[model samples]
Target: MNIEDIKQRITGFSNELYPFAHALIPEELQAQQLVIDGISFLFADKDCKTRLFDLLEVTEHEFVNKEFFDLKKVSIKVIYALAKKRFTQLESGLDINQFGVFYRLGLSARAALFLKYKFGFDADEVSEILSLSRIEVMTLTHESRSHMVDFIRPVQEGLQQ
Candidate 1:
């Protein structure tokens, strides 16, 4: 693929994962930053899916604002090498909102949900990416599904909205 094409694909895929990012951070701006930084740093040589898993695994202390790998060309590197942007606003905490509910889940559990439901990876694939056994992925998926229902359902008159 051409340089532009690959960048475009990466950006598009990153946007598709924004909701997951937002849920992970519970702040729209920080989530956007994750996507932006991810696009800037993706290695063309590395598998995109594995890179994405690495991204989610990055803790705040591990975040690198600069690009390291360009898939190879300096031209490709230049295209994605935009200045890093940071949002200084106070990020939201876990509350009753959809994002908050999602944030309450352990990071691995949340990743398991997004990997399976959002990205359509089967348990085997998720296990490989997450470094968990197949059984653990299955269990995480099951528990995450059970938790999702309460927050996802419509609020009845008698229940808390």
Candidate 2:
């Protein structure tokens, strides 16, 4: 695809990826740069789209256990997952955005959780993108959920009072 098409596709998912980038990188400029760099890297991969299509063509899969499927959603999720890693590597220090429980986890755990929950990717897809095992993704996702619940409990208790 042409650069414009690639840019357009990235922009289509900017709503989700931008916040993710911001959270991971801390500095606004570096985060934006990371996103740009990520897009470049993704386009450079060239075979990314082909790999995604190959995944779709599978009947008995090595990853996901679900029967339901959607190509558009999966495509977007795959892109987001890949970009999230690129953005994350731009982290230089602990000056991360401390606005969420996700920050409490390690980088990989946070990325896995964000891809699965915020970006709506399956555990298998997240594993493929992040290079983690399915079990690792599952564990991170569970931890993320638990952390969120723990973080919200105080607020919930106060509201009940």
Candidate 3:
């Protein structure tokens, strides 16, 4: 199939799999486009699919038995993660105008890291790994850490409530 056809299929599948995911995303337009772009990349390249599937497998394994958490909350957490990462990368970056896209990227990066460190998947195993360069990976790592810190602190504070 052509790239457009593959993107369409992937979009349809994503909507079905994560029906609430779109709404939870910060930037609607960018979020939608990212999904389309990811699918298009997967369709046009076999290696990309392998990497994506590898990451997916890792996510599934890590989250399989976890308690049910609000997807929206998770989405917010993911966005925060991405935003933090992007900001660090840009250092002098402005606020993310495309919240939806930012959230999606964060989610993707989180899933990728979870798979790599949490599930023992090597960086080379997953598809189109988010950080192909040292700088990108470092930025992502810092963002992910910040996201986690922000995410957990709230919960800790809530428990004292």
Candidate 4:
């Protein structure tokens, strides 16, 4: 499907997941605008609608649990992770592909950890929930430390609102 279609699907999924005021703009108009802007920023040359669709599909699969209804919290974490990685990559002159993979993995790992912590899961339970081996879980936990700081500090700030 096209970017507009993908965005509409995301909006529908978001609406199902959380209670929020609808945008003043018409849904399709807003979706189209978002698609256009996102493409301009992220994938200027080639069509990114398909990539966005893939990302959203993965995110939807990962976040379907009722515990993730807090979209604001999830969004803050994601933004913080992306920003942190971007800044670090700039400073270190890291390969963009590596930076992107780390950022995405960090976000997913953080979300899984948040679910485990908030939901009070045992080790076995956490492993099962995340579909990760113990070694992978440990590695993710270690790698996620800096990202967690980035992800959580903003959420704490937002809580003051």
After superposing candidate 4 on the true structure, give the runs of residues whose Cα lies further than 4 Å from its correct spot.
1-107, 150-161
Clashes of each: 1, 0, 6, 0
Give candidate 3 misplaced runs (Cα > 4 Å). 1-13, 16-25, 42-122, 126-128, 133-143, 154-161
Question: What lDDT tens digits, residue by residue, belong to model 4 across residues 1-161?
Answer: 34575455545544321211111111343334433332234333233334454454454554433322332233322333343444444434533344333344443464445444554445554455455776776666666666646644556656784
Q: Estimate, for each residue in 47-151, the C-alpha lDDT of model 3 and write its tens digit.
A: 545543444334354342231122222232333344345445543343444443334345556555554555354544323334355456556656776775665
Pairs that clash in candidate 3: 26-99, 26-100, 27-99, 27-100, 51-126, 51-127
What is the lDDT of every predicted structure here? 0.55, 0.58, 0.43, 0.41
The all-Cα superposition gives candidate 1 an RMSD in Å to the true structure of: 11.6
Ranking by lDDT: 2, 1, 3, 4
lDDT of 2 by residue, 24-114 (tens): 5455775566555554554455565554344445556433223213333444344456546654565555544564566666656767776
Residue 114 lDDT (model 1): 74
lDDT for model 3, please. 0.43
Cα shift from native, residue 155, model 3 (Å): 11
| Residue ranges of candidate 2 with Cα displaced over 4 Å | 1-7, 10-16, 46-93, 155-161
In candidate 1, what are the lDDT values of residues 1-161, reduced to their tens digit? 23554446465656565665554455667667665655554554356445544544454432422211222222222222221122222323335255466766766677678768876778886776566899999999898889878767877886855
- Native-vs-model 1 lDDT? 0.55
